[model samples]
Target: MNTRGQFLSSRLVNDSLISLFVVSTFPPFRISFQLRMWDWFQQYCPWVLQGISMVYGMIVRIRRKAYQREWLRPKHLSRPVVSVGNITVGGTGKTPFVIWLAHQLHAKGQRVAILSRGYGRQDPSKNLMVSDGKGHVKEWRVSGDEPTMIAQHCPWALVAVGPDRFRLGQWVLEQTPCDCFILDDGYQHLSLYRDLDLLLFDATDVKGLCGVLPAGRLREPLDSAKGAAAFIFTRSETLSSIQPVQTCIEKVIGQSINPIVLKMVPKQVRHLVTGEVQPLTFFSQRSLLVVSGIGNPRSFCDILTGCGLEVGEEIRFPDHCAYGQDEANLILEKIGQSDQDIVVTTEKDAVKLREWFSKDDPVWFVTTDLEFLAGEEHILGLLDRAGVV
Candidate 1:
């Protein structure tokens, strides 16, 4: 009516406030509102993280009492090593339980190698190998994403990487005819020597064991798993939901241990460019689309929406993400304009999107394992007391 109808109603209220600030900055609404503000600072800042987890649990009990009195010893390697790790950082599946403990010591014939301080390697200080147990000759950014997804699922098992894992376990036990050595994420790698440390966790991480790095999500503390001898509980489902987490780990390491539980599942959906093996009812109710970079993308979208599928959309990244090809053509143009139909991910993001997908790309990858709901033969008697049977 007046000055050009008041400049067309102030440009329609500044274009609806710039479309609600770009739909609240998209990308899964800014990664689920920055993970609900880091889960309300790890659950209402436990009494303000008890004075920074008591000066970060007193430097993790003085670097674990300087590797227990020896003022730092740990460094042997003439075989026997076994160490699958985790105390709480994320993804406590520890590379699918170190490819199910390297297929239970490569199905009895023994001889498995793993080692890995590789986490997202590029030139992680050079020491490579990535696989010599038969495949993946190197490159998941130089063997990193969980040691290239455990050397593409234990090709016989021998995945290596460096940053000094006790000199990369004396250079993959002098390069091969190896007899043991698993170690990926070796329980805080206190310089090496490990005839079994096996401490993994994540039946929902017990409130991220209350504080260490940046204030929670412990990297140490929980007495660094008190020199772990048992405790394996990954995303459990049964065995009486692990009896109040085995009475809260026997009142936090005051003894009473023996707890295993496992139950992971989703054992393989494959095909990231023709390895095939698809049918898990072709992902049940379809319309899927779940991407990852892992470190618990909500337990990989609640274990693929509890296997029935129907994810709709999710694309998290920041946790070892490397998928190049301009991030696979922006994740194939956001799953080709939505309404999904396919695109699952996580054999650690399908080993970094197999050189960025191509051969008729429909892309898939499920592969999870760990099933021993109630001490399955007590994890083969702790891998026969770590001597690898």
Candidate 2:
């Protein structure tokens, strides 16, 4: 089907399904008669809206040889390249894992650098570097949420953003005598050869995706998991039977690859307005207004409620969405009217808020990271094989 038809089809499906659920809950609404029209729309509009994206992928795949001919042939920099990426769209926990991995490598006295595309960055024209004015300062955009967070935490490490990963990698090698490189969110970037591919999978979306794009959320097929030296499962906190789930995923990974189970548990809940770090127990008595502009809002809300927070409201926005002053003011206004309600947000949104919102605003940013519990050995062993450690 054409692009227009495909989009209409997807919209029809979404609208019809939503209408059905809403009508079921509100039988007195009298919108049940419109169900026939919805069904008709769904039938006539049955097509795929992702046709262009799928076609683009196909063209790239077809021309893989042409692109590979002049791929970034970087001279072996001192440090090995460990890429953290996923086959699907979002919510893979790449940033936290990279931070965790960097901290681990830094502890071993190895100089590390991070390269990323800096998704959702407003300016994509030039190469930018983010650092804390130390030896690792390189040209990469510091404006990105992830890069800024990395720079803030790992001030000593170099982080750069560029469309051309190979050029950026070479530039890093020239500027800093780094021992290793960590590719952030670079699962499908095949132009620059990576020594190790680390793929992350969100357990919720793993069940029903085709191999190509447009049909499902995946950038590639489920078999794409095989490319990674290791597979890390994000949102592991949701799994009731964690051990059995890990076993099943490990079986899919086979003998050659290792399975890493990482969970993003609530370590602490900070008061958004006061910046005071409190134990998660503080959430039990709080009337929370949970706000997050992250890849997975459901997960964020779940974590808050799971920690015993009475989630009275949840405001979710697009991933890396830049909030205007007025939008934040509205939230502030709502909070002001509440009875000492705690306004909660994620670290990513926190960065944007700090940059955009007034300093005196009561909104608080709570940070969370992926915690690799049992499979640290497996991940470390893979890095060892790559000679990164």
Clashes in candidate 2: how many?
A: 9
Q: What is the C-alpha lDDT of each candidate?
A: 0.72, 0.65
* TM-score for each model: 0.33, 0.78
Each model's backbone clash number: 0, 9
lDDT of 2 by residue, 71-180 (tens): 53433444588899987665667888888999999998888888887765778656777673384543222357788777777888888888888788887777767888
For candidate 1, the lDDT comes to 0.72
Candidate 1 residue-wise lDDT, 1-389, digit = tens = 11100111111322111211211122445644655654576578656645776787798779888988888898888888888888767677877778877887889888788878787677888788878887756777777788877777677778888888888778777766788888888788887888878887777556666556556666777766778877888888887766665666577778888888887888768888787887667778777777676677667667777777777766555577665665576667766767775888877777778877876878788876677877868878888976777
Instruction: Give the distance in Å from residue 365's predicted Cα in candidate 1 to where it truly belongs.
Output: 4.7
**C-alpha root-mean-square deviation, candidate 2:** 8.0
Q: What is the lDDT of residue 61 in candidate 2?
A: 52
